[model samples]
Structures are given as C-alpha cells and as structure tokens.
Target: MTYELRDHTADVAVEATADTLSALFAAVADGLAAASAESVPDEGDRFEFEVAAEGREALLFDYLDRLIYERDVRLVLPADHRCAVVGPGEGDSGTGPSDPDEWRLTASARGVPLDAVAAREIKAVTYSEMALERRGDEWYAYVVFDV
Candidate 1:
C-alpha cells in the first residue's frame, strides 16, 4: 500500500493504492497515521465492521469515515486489514459487502493514547469528486475529508 498527500480545498487530500481493497484501506490508515505524525502502539486491538454504499465513491467515503469514527470514538488505528469482494456486480455499486461486488474487511489496529498529539480532526468523509478504480492489477482511490 502507498499514500501521498496533495493540495485540496479541504484540510488535506489523500491518494492511496493497493493490490486489494483490504490493502488499500490499510494503506489509507497508515496515511492517516502519518498525517497525525503520532506513534501508534503496536498491540493487538482488533475491530470488525461492515459498510455498504450505492457506489464506489460512497463506499470509499464510508470506509474512511469508519476509520475516522474509530479514531475519534474508539481511539483505534488500523494496523492490518483483509478485504474480499463477496458479491456480484461491477463498478462502485458492485464493490460493497452485500452486493455481488461487495467486500468484507477484517482488520487489526493499534490504540492511540488519549494524550496523543492532536492532529486535524476529520469531520466527515466527502463525495466532493472522490474517485475509486482499478488500473491493471492494482486498485486506486482518491478521497477528500472535511476537517
């Protein structure tokens, strides 16, 4: 997985890619960790979740929103993830948990201390021109969040 920060109208923009959706989400978590510049404790604190959306952009937004919510509400930082498409279909709608193109993600994350450095607070995931697609063997996504 890989992540890069870019200029955006919001607090920041993130671009991530991976061989699989799980890898992509994991990379996005690492990117979020990097954004905070905080050292996440390496402990086995696992969480399970499922999200569905009408399209790929919505799915991506939901994925990130879950991460942010976990951070804010649960203080969890994703360390590893495994996502698989379980449903059928194509494109965004096809790429979900219930759809034929659905994906199921199981992940392990570290817990951030309450006294950790405060970074930008992610308010919500945005659909302001988000993108998700596949290029050959890799999956790619671009996301913007309201801070």
Candidate 2:
C-alpha cells in the first residue's frame, strides 16, 4: 500500500492505493498516522468496529471516520486492521464470501499518553469528493479530512 499527501483548502487530501480494499483502508490509516506524526506502537490495545454505508463512497467515509474516531475520541492510533464487508449485490458489493460494501474492522492502535506532545488531533473524516476505484489489479481511494 502507498499514499501521497496533497494540499487542501482547510484540511488535507490523501490518495491511497493497494491490491485490495482491505489493504487500501490500511494504507489510508497509515497515511493518517503519517500526517499526525505519531508512531503506531507495536504493542497496544485492540478494538473491534463495524461501519455500514449506503454505497462505496459512504463506505470509505465511514471506514475512515471510524479510524479517526478511534484516534480523536478513544485516543488510539491503529497499527493494523482486518476488515471485511457484509451484505451487498455484486462488484464492490457481493453475495460472495468476501465483499467490499459493509465492513467490520479489528484494529490495533497505540494509546494516547497524557503528556504526548507529538500527537496531532483529527477533527473528522469528510466525504468531500471522496473517490474509490479499481484499476486493473489494484484498488485506489482518495479522501479529504476536515481538520
């Protein structure tokens, strides 16, 4: 997975790509971590989260929102995640065993310390012109956050 940071009006734009949706989401989270300049601790607490969206765009928004929530609200910086979509029709959404519509993510993140000056706060994840697409064998996503 890989990501590039772009300038935005208010917040920041992140473009991420991976071989699969799950990897894409993970790359997005890593991008967020990089933006914050906070290292994801190798040893930390684990949490389980589930997000449902109307479609692909909303799904990506919700997924990123969950990660931001963990960071801002729960004060956790996730290092790894296992995500899978539940329910759907076909393509991004499927009736097969693995789909990319709805998602359940189990993540490991570092806990925020009381005197951590290096940690940066994220206000929220935005859906402003967010994009998710599949090209050849890779999956790509573009997102902007409201910091």
Candidate 3:
C-alpha cells in the first residue's frame, strides 16, 4: 500500500493505491492519520469500527468520514490501520454492481490520545473529485478533505 498527500485548493487531498481494495482503504486511512499529526506514535491505543455503504464511492467516503469521526469524538491520533473489505460486496454473486447497499468495511486502527501528540484537525471528507477504481492490477483512491 502507498499514499501521498496532494494540494486541493483550499482543502487537502490524499492519493492512495494498493494491490487490493482492502489495502487501498488502509492506505487512505494511513494518509489521513499522517495528516492529523506530524508523527503518530505507535504502541498507544486501539479502536475498531465497521462501515457499510451502497457502493464503492460511498464506501470510500464513509470510511474516511468514520475515521475522522473517531478522531474527533474520541480525541485520538491514529498510528496504524488495518482495513478489510468484508461481506458480500457488490458483484460478489454475478449480480453486477446493481446493489449499492450491500458493501461493508471492517477497520481496526491504533493511536494515542490527542493530547499525547501534535495533531491538526480535519474538518470533514468531501465528495469533490473523490474517486475509487481499479486500473490494471492496482486499486486507486483519491479523496479530498475539508481541512
């Protein structure tokens, strides 16, 4: 998995790529964690959450939004992430991408309390220019956050 931060006019954006959809989500989480703090200290605390969406686009959006919510509500700075594309996602049983509400994401992240690290708050994740797709052998994601 790999991720990079990009300039998004008045906001901040992340470009993430991975060999699988699961890794792509994890990479995006890692990018968001890095954006929250200069350095996320390991060996702190752990938190896990699950998210479901109608489709890939909303899945990505909800995944990031969920992470941001965790940081804001729990006052934590994430250091590590583990994400998996679980359940019968779209196109699982020769049904094509017709059902949008059947996809789910299971994520586990570790972090320290916000007071223990220097962090920059991310206001929200936006849909502008948001993308998730498969190209060749890699899955790519592009997301912009309202910072």
Candidate 4:
C-alpha cells in the first residue's frame, strides 16, 4: 500500500493505492494521520472504531471524519492503522454469497498522545474532489481534507 500528499490551495489531498480495498482504507487512514503530525511513533495506545454506509466513498469520508473527532476528543494522534471494509448487507440472509449492496468499515489503530507529537490541526475531511475506484487488481482513492 502507498499514499502521497497532494498540494491544495488551503487544504491537503491524499491519494492512495493498494492491492485490496481494506488495505486501501488503511492507507488513506495513514495519510490522514500523517497530515496531522510530522512524525508518529510506531507504538501507541490501541483504538478501535466502526462505520457503515451505502457506498465506499461515503464510508471513507465517515471513517476519516470519525478519526478527526476521536483525535479532538481523545487528544491523540492516530496511527499504525489497520481496517477491514465489509458489505452493506453483511449479516442479511437474503444477499446470499453474492456482493452486498452496502458497506462497512471496522478499523483498529494506534493512538499517540497529542502532547507527544509535533502536530498540526486539520479542521475536517471534506468531500471536494473526493474519489474512490478500482482498476484491475488495485484500488485507488483521492480524499481532500480541510486543513
């Protein structure tokens, strides 16, 4: 998985690519964490969260937004991300084995105390220029954050 920070006029955009959808989510999460601090320690307190949505793009937005909320409330710089993105009808019996219509994301991350990192304030994650797509065996996403 890989991600790069894109220059935005008054914000920052993260473009990430990964081999799988779940890894893509984690890469984007790592991008957001990098946007918050210059350097994040490898070790931190464990943090877990979940979000559900009708589409992948919206789920990405919610996931990042939640991280921002967690950062502000818990006073931590979230990092070392891991996540799994599941289906819209994950538990429904009618869907059978075919792909479901909705999506869900469950993420586990390490959070370093805000005081321990040299940090910057990211106001929020925005929908402007946001994107998510798949090409062949790879997944890609572009997300803009209101810095």
lDDT tens string, model 4, 32-131? 9888888987767898887777788988999999999999999988899899888665575332454467687778889899888999899999999998
Q: Locate the minimum summed-lDDT window of 10 residues in model 4.
A: 90-99
Q: CA lDDT, every prediction?
A: 0.63, 0.67, 0.83, 0.87
Q: Give the winner by lDDT.
A: 4
lDDT of 1 at 143: 72
Listed in order, each prediction's TM-score against the native is 0.72, 0.75, 0.88, 0.90
What are the candidates' C-alpha RMSDs? 4.4, 4.4, 4.1, 3.5
Best by TM-score: 4
Taking all chains together, the TM-score of candidate 3 against the true structure is 0.88
For model 3, the superposed segments whose C-alpha errors exceed 4 Å read 87-101
Each prediction's number of clashing residue pairs: 7, 1, 1, 2
Tell me the spans in candidate 2 whose CA falls farther than 4 Å from its real position: 86-117
Candidate 4, superposed: residue stretches over 4 Å from native: 89-100
Cα lDDT tens digits, model 2, 1-147, are 898877789788889999978778778877776666545445565676666666766777777777777766665565565566433553443233554444444334444432443656667778787888998999888888776
- Candidate ranking under TM-score, highest first, comes to 4, 3, 2, 1
* Residue ranges of candidate 1 with Cα displaced over 4 Å: 38-44, 76-103
* Ten residues in sequence with the least summed lDDT for candidate 3: 89-98
